[model samples]
Every structure is written in C-alpha cells, then in structure tokens.
Target: MKKILILFLSIVIFSCKKEEKGFSDYLRSLDTLVLPQKFSLNSTMNSSNKYDSILFKKYKHRWTYAPYGIAFNNERIVGIIEYSIADNGLAPFLITFDNNGNKIDSLNILGNSSFGMKGQTLESAILDTNLKLVVIDSSKSWQVDIDANKIPNTTKLRVSTTIYKIQKNGKIKKIK
Candidate 1:
C-alpha cells in the first residue's frame, strides 16, 4: 500500500513537472526574426512615404475603403485597393507601377462579376513563390437560434472562400 501510494504521487508530480514550458515560454526561447530589406521609391513615387494612398469616389452611403495589399516583382510594384458600396460588400481593383514609381496600369476587377458574386467582399491577397498573386475573397452569413438552455446560439454561419491568380499580363483568374 505504501509503495503504491508513493508511485501514484510520484507519477502525478512527474506529470506536472513535464508541462513546465508552455506556449509563452516556447515563444520566448525563439531567436528574433530578421526582416527583408525595405523597398526604396524614387521621385516618380509622387508621395514621399513608402506607402501611397489613392482615394476612391466618395459618397454619403455607409462605406469603407482601404489599400489592401502590395507586392513587388522583378520590374514593377502591384497594389490591391478595395472599397465598399453600402449594401454591396467589397469591390477590389489592381494598380501597377514601374520600378521608378510611374503608373503602369490600373485595372478595375469588379465590373463584370468575374472575381466573385456581385456583392461578395475581397479579404486579402499575397504573392506566391512564383511571384504570381494569390488572392482570397470571402463572404459570411450567420443566423441565431434558441438553444435548450434558452440562450441565443449561432446555429448557422455560412462562409464562402474564393482564391484568384493574377498573371503577368494583368489578367485575373479564379483558380479555387
């Protein structure tokens, strides 16, 4: 009986000791990350800041607009800009500039409903290993219902995602 008690207590103490390091401790143990070199813009950039904001058409409706993402290839920098039109969720556009910051082309991606449905929103975008652009467009709808405990619970939350690929010639292709 004494040996069994000692073994059980030892096992409990050992188990507790094994969990000494948690997520926070693990994070502290990692070395600081080194970031890549910053991009330098020339006189052609127009604005002195590294990031330039281009405004869209203004309206009295409840709407929001922002510069979403930016990526650079061998010779050009690409920016994804988004705007909201009240009942319509998000509309995104792509603009390209040369290395010297001169405007190369500006393409509106929402006119024909090719990127997503008429009212869906664009969430984010990033450049892939091949320098091709990968974009995420999403829409979400939710419903609440009463549970057995008389509490309102989210019974359904529908989320849809779309991935697009941007080619070198400034064409948008839905790949997923």
Candidate 2:
C-alpha cells in the first residue's frame, strides 16, 4: 500500500503540469522565437564592441537572445534560443524555420529546478521527431529553492528535465 500511495502521488504531481490552452496561447509563446530561415554565415561576428555585420541580431540590451545548439531534420532548420531578461534569467525556445524565412513551428519551454519546481536558466535544448524537447539546465544544485518539510534536500542534484513527447498541440509530456 505504501508503494501504491507513492506511485499515485507521483502520478498526481507529474500530471499537474500546465497544458496549452488554444491557438492564441501557442501563438503567443512562439511569437518571440520567430527567426530568419535563410541565414548566411556571420563574417563580422565577435569583431569588437561596436560589432558590424548582418548575421546576428542580438545586442547587449536588458535581455539576451542567443542560440546554444541547433538540430536539423532533413533540410529544415531547427534552432534553440536562450533568452534571458534583466534579472529573471534565461528561457528556452525551440524553433523551426522553413527555407523561405517562414517559421514552421516554435515551442517556448520553461526550465525546471532540481527541486522539481518551475524556474529559469535553460542551458541547451534539442527537439526530436515528435517535437519532444530535451533540455539541459545550467542552474546548479544550490540554485534550487529549499524549505522545511521538503526535507533532505539533494544538494548534489542538479536542475535537469527531459520531456518525452511534445504533442502536436504544443503540450509537453514529461517522462521519467
């Protein structure tokens, strides 16, 4: 019975993840991730403080929009974006663009802490066939919040989450 209770609680906690509401919700998440499809190499990247060239659109503003890793499916260009706000930290975006600068699809995935709580600072991301996202969090174990009752904190545990199946509807299904 103890094992059964634990299993039941696990299911409950896992199932509590939010779901995508509708087209509007999905669209809002993807809007910030739109990118150029046919991108040329950056000849002037990392030149100087006043960098010149047209390959990168990122600047040292209040936030950073950058790419960590990218995956390609056949000819489709799939890119992962790591955007960090002023004091908030980094957020991940899974995006796919067509050959004509059109966005095929995008997924705005949030980072989770080792405490199993939702947070930020996603380091890298990769998308599979079903749009399932494999994310790596850069937040160290000490970054996760801890409280009483949630006793015996895993000081050695790090923030990491691997989502199994990303439904066509833009919902993430986490796998153990």
Candidate 3:
C-alpha cells in the first residue's frame, strides 16, 4: 500500500510540473511567431490545444481554440486565435496579452453567416504592419415571391468597411 501511494503521488507531482513548464514554453514560442502582411483564417491549419484550458476557461466544451499568429510591440503581445464551436466554421479573434501571458483584451476579426431564406453575410479582415486592422463585410439579400413558388425577385448587395487599431497598451480601438 505504501509503495502504491508513493507512485501515485510522484506521478501527480511530475504532471503538475510538466504543465507549468509547458505553459511558459508556449508563451516564449509566441514571441518568435512570424505573421504575414495579410492573413486569412485557414480552418485546415494545424492547431495546438495546450492553451485551451487557460484561454477558453469560460467557453463551452464544444469550442476549440487555435493560435493563428502573434505580434509583439514594446508593451504587449498581440495574437490571433481562431475559435470554432462544435463543427461550425472557424472565427478569428485578435487577442492582446501582457508580457507575462495575461489576457488584456480581444476583438473578433471576422464572422461569416448564411441565412437560408433571408440573406447571407461574409466578413474578412486585413492586418497591416502598423497594427491597423480593416474588416470588410459584404451581405446579400433577395426578395422571394411566395406566390411564385418562392422564386427570387430582387436582390440587394451591400458592403461596408470598419477599421481598428491595436494600441501598445493591449487595447483595441475602433478607428472607423
């Protein structure tokens, strides 16, 4: 009985130490991440679930997080993390963290949706070197004539653009 208890305690202690080291190593790796001038969220890209426990603490069990890219300024670390709920498509978010790996703020980068009978909307974002983010949203809706066997009558397409700035202090500000 004594030997069995000792073995179990040893395993638990070693596992805890490994988890602590993994978290710090992960944060250091973020500093070396290379980001492109224009990046679109790719759902097929490989993802790490190591930080899911830390980052998605309050999220539902069906949600998953994937780190897209990371940028470093003098004061903060900006990272793009993609989230997916269940089997739904991925959505990217720009999350800011302090130097010690504490989350400061976050903003959704893009979200696309399709309305079966009403309309559909698509969104995308581009991040420039100066920490400027531009989000473009395009939507389309059509009028359906129920009397005509639900045939489409008229369609309207709308496009809009919004801009945001990620400041050095880990804050996201909407500039447009």
Q: Top model by lDDT, which number?
A: 3
Off by over 4 Å in 2: 1-53, 58-64, 85-88, 111-131, 134-176
Q: Write the per-residue lDDT of candidate 2 for residues 1-176, one digit (tens) a residue.
A: 99999999999998997673432222223323222211111111111232221323421112335443333333434333433332233444445444333455555554342223432243455455445566556563333335433323554435665555544433345674
The C-alpha lDDT values of all candidates are 0.38, 0.40, 0.60
Query: What number of clashing residue pairs does each candidate have, in the order they appear?
Result: 0, 0, 0
Candidate 3, after superposition: displacement of residue 161 in Å? 0.5
Q: Which of candidates 1 and 3 reaches a greater lDDT?
A: 3
Over 4 Å off, model 1: 1-70, 75-93, 97-122, 132-140, 143-151
Error of 3 at 86 (Å): 6.9
Model 1 — TM-score against the truth? 0.33
lDDT, model 1:
0.38
lDDT of 3 by residue, 48-123 (tens): 4344445444321233355544554454464545455322356666677666666777776665544446676777
Pairs that clash in candidate 1: none
